[model samples]
Target: MKWTEVQEIAIQLSERHPETDPAKVNFVDLMKWTMALPEFDDDPKHCGERVLEAIQQAWIDEVA
Candidate 1:
């Protein structure tokens, strides 16, 4: 996905999780964390999507 799309997704996630501070949420760090997850061990693409979803979910959980 494009950086613009990633940024928009990040913004939406930030809005969902006020405590996450999207400004401070480094995409690279998030990718690293997501890749480290056991569930993503088999697929890099899935890991990436999971990371994005996790970021969004974490943000939502934080704000909710």
Candidate 2:
């Protein structure tokens, strides 16, 4: 999926790491994990703080 696919990414993250709390994830690790997702394919340079924030927020929603 693309960087704009926030919910999809969150779902992947949630499923991949069901034991972790998305709210506590740091951008450094978050970005790393997102890149590692099997469906993920994009330039790392495209991600910014706002994109990370959206991913984190979506993850929070996903888990809640």
Write down the RMSD of all candidates, one decimal each: 8.3, 0.4
Candidate 1 lDDT, tens digit per residue, 1-64?
Answer: 3322444444444544455554466667666644444333444455455556556555555555
TM-score of 1: 0.35
| TM-score of every prediction relative to native | 0.35, 0.98
Deviating ranges (above 4 Å) for candidate 2: none
Clashes of each: 1, 0
Error at 53, model 1, angstroms: 8.0
Q: List the residue pairs that clash in candidate 2.
A: none
